[model samples]
Target chain A: MYEGVVQDLIDELGRFPGVGPKSAQRIAFHLLNSDPADINRLREVLGKVAEGVTFCEVCGTVAEQQRCRICRDERRDATLVCVVEEPKDVLAVERTGEFKGRYHVLGGALDPLSGIGPDQLRMRELLARIGTDEITEVILATDPNTEGEATATYLVRMLRDFPGLTVTRLASGLPMGGDLEFADELTLGRALSGRRAL
Target chain B: MYEGVVQDLIDELGRFPGVGPKSAQRIAFHLLNSDPADINRLREVLGKVAEGVTFCEVCGTVAEQQRCRICRDERRDATLVCVVEEPKDVLAVERTGEFKGRYHVLGGALDPLSGIGPDQLRMRELLARIGTDEITEVILATDPNTEGEATATYLVRMLRDFPGLTVTRLASGLPMGGDLEFADELTLGRALSGRRAL
Candidate 1:
């Protein structure tokens, strides 16, 4: 429908996770209209990413070098490690400004149907860090989905024998600023069963 | 929240039309995880687009050479011209397989709020082409919105002085696959006004 390279560009843009054909066309046109410098900047960044993003050797999060910023920061409590599903989850926890601990990114949750088991994720690396770093507590910060829950459960079993290491899961309840009526029964049940006194 | 170049890649991806921050991050991660060949292919296409695209000398649609495929084809009706607002609209009309005429892309409509007017568009070039092309009919195929209507109305006035030229507009009625009950009053009124004698 368009010139050769223009159509090609649109097709390529459409391959992105959430971009539809219309959005691909829109983005292609946007790139066409953008400054050459801007386009080149994006291209340069992509080229660098293609070269590969380094992951931290300790906790398996994205890093510029062998270790991530959090792993390298001496101020953060290394004894407390937050276990999560992906590198992105590390940022989600960091955004809260509440956690003063380090992170252990598991690459992804255990989805046996998808063939992603303990061997596929960074679970071994996480366990090794806990054993060597004298980590006192492990907080399961995985998403509250089926796969996440399953991964957390498996990790609890794996960490049960680690002496003096406390394991905890994130609390689930009605979200702040959300209507109670809108909360699903499962969440409402969790909130009821996990009730705490002030 | 990410490494230097990785975060730069995410920021660049976010600049694409319709891609929000989360989608940008997802795309960035996808690119990071994708084979190097895929990233390079997309990059190569963007580079070609950044080099610049050629517009048809005759119809103002995207073209590899002096004229578009439709304008260059000898079989198309030389005496009929389809005036559209963008190159994408040419594809829309072509997809219907109903029209066999060349196109005149106005680039955009009379969007005065955005500082677009007759002079800003390809109006003068269109008039010049009509003077020399021996065109007998002009089909106004702009969009159905306010700006498209204004441009179509303006073109009608411009083409009126040419003798032997028939100016026509694409019909304004309910779309073929659309439900009449779901249509707005304006569209329903247009449908009533432009009812064909079947």
Candidate 2:
């Protein structure tokens, strides 16, 4: 609905994930009104990220170099690996400061309807990492959704062949600080069944 | 929270209007996974918009040239002028297709706390336009919010000195297709007061 360059900018911004047409327009106008230096800086950063960022060769996580920071950090427990569905999930887990293990980003979870299968993910690379690395425990920390469960189930069945390797899934329960009354039935059921002796 | 260029991209994307930290990170990762050509295209468009777009000399609206399309169009009713807050407001009024008059963008409203007074806006330009042009009617089409109402009130008082000019404010009432039950008290009051005979 705008003229020339303004419309072009809006169209480009609309391509970003979660940026709808209204948001795209608002952003474009905001950029138009902002300092020229700020816009130039954004453009420069975008160009640099597009050219520099690449998937980690070992774990499929986003990296500026061959391997991601977690993979390169020798201090992290290499014996324990936490497997997640995407690079963002790695950040989510890391924020808790609970897991000292390395991560393996699967690129995506299993969704046959969307044409994403085990082969489409980094399953082969994961298997290779487990076989070669002295990984003692594998933590399946994928989402609690259906696709995540499916992917975890597939991985558990495959990992059964590796002797002396322990496999574990992240616990499912009412979130920390959440009210019991607000907990969904499925989550409440799981929390009740998985209750541990206090 | 990310490495090098990846974090830089997220920071830049976060600067955009309505994009929070999490959304910025998601957009950054999405761009990292997207084609290099797409990113380059976005960069090129941003550069073009920053370099090319300038405010219209006639009405203060964003334009590629000195004059906006509405000001340049000879067929538009020059005798009727509609006053609005920002360049975006011009687009909103235009979308309604109810008015064929030219526009005079006020740049902003009269916010006393923010130190934005009449002098800060394009009031001088608006008065100059009214003095020079054969404008028969001046419609105050500012927003329905507090600042917009203040601006409209200020303009109405200012325009009173000009003889042979019909100054009017846009009618305030319940929005079209909005349920009466959901309408706020102020809006319901305005709707009742402004009710027209069948």
Candidate 3:
């Protein structure tokens, strides 16, 4: 352990996801040698984040203004909304350049054991959007894990009441550059079941 | 990329050593969900480090007071001093429970290519301590790398001028519990050359 604030800094940094004790020590020492300007910049950024970084009122994704840039853009297809688990998912979908529609950030997927349910997510807001925004479709782009699948199933049941709303899920198959021989059983099973004519 | 302060926070976190872009993104989102108090604590620690973390005036290691804990302890042998490259090195040696003497942190080893020389380190302070503090033995415990070896050689030449001062260097050989077969030629040769009659 180090003296005073240096050790304190290491302990604090270790709390971040994926940062082990050794990594925390390395980062702390690097910061110790960093310029005051650089350290102040990090502190200022953290201060801003702690002071309540704005989330889009409509989509629930982090935003600068009242809504996210995607929500603000007129060219985005508002009628075709993409339902995602978090703001990071929005970025991942956006990177593909295949999603031109707006997004509805669910904050997190369903995990009852972890005390996360529909009430914990933005399911009510999503229903509200479908009812009032003249939405034609909602793409369920949650992760392929248990919690994400549960959230999708719950959303499907809740959304069945609405008419003429097409619900789709992101395809699950072999990754673009993956080798079939090395594919896992679950992924290969999914690919075989969801095979396309093409 | 994210928008507003969220993106700024991610960018700032990426500046830390070993935090790549994806890791930076993950850390940013983790911090976004972390309790406000946790984030505040990190900010406060960085603030203290930026405001100028105190260093031991005598040994040049990070300290809470005018001197380090080892330096302040009256039971510690002031007649003996272990020389190290950094404060972290001091901790490494202290963990062995063998060295009960105080330490003199050199901050860094000699690396002329990086424009660091004897003046850049605590060479003058070390010399002054030998002259006035009546120190009997000085142990050179810098790293085993090229820069550390150069520093030890320079210090050896400089400390030879002292009449009764006994200067020593750490033994070089294969690490404990390490396989002799896997040991490099350099280490194997050092162990052979420095053989003892046990």
Per prediction, the TM-score for chain B is 0.97, 0.95, 0.97
Best by lDDT: 3
Please report, as a residue range, the 10-residue window in candidate 1 chain B with the lowest summed lDDT.
B43-52
Candidate 2 residue-wise lDDT, B1-198, digit = tens: 876788888888888889999999888878888898999999999888767587899999988778989999999999999999988889999999999999999998999999999999999999999999999999999999999999999999999889899999899999999999999999999989999999
What do the candidate models score in CA lDDT, each in turn?
0.91, 0.91, 0.92
TM, every model: 0.93, 0.90, 0.97
- Give stretches of model 2 more than 4 Å off: A178-185, B177-198
Report the number of the highest-DockQ candidate.
Answer: 3
Residue A14 of model 2 has an lDDT of: 93
Error of 2 at B87 (Å): 1.5
Between candidates 2 and 3, the lDDT winner: 3
Docking class of 2: medium
Q: RMSD of model 3, in Å?
A: 1.2
**Which candidate's TM-score is highest?**
3
Provide fnat values for all models in the order shown.
0.80, 0.73, 0.79
In angstroms, give how far residue A84 of model 3 lies from its true place: 0.8
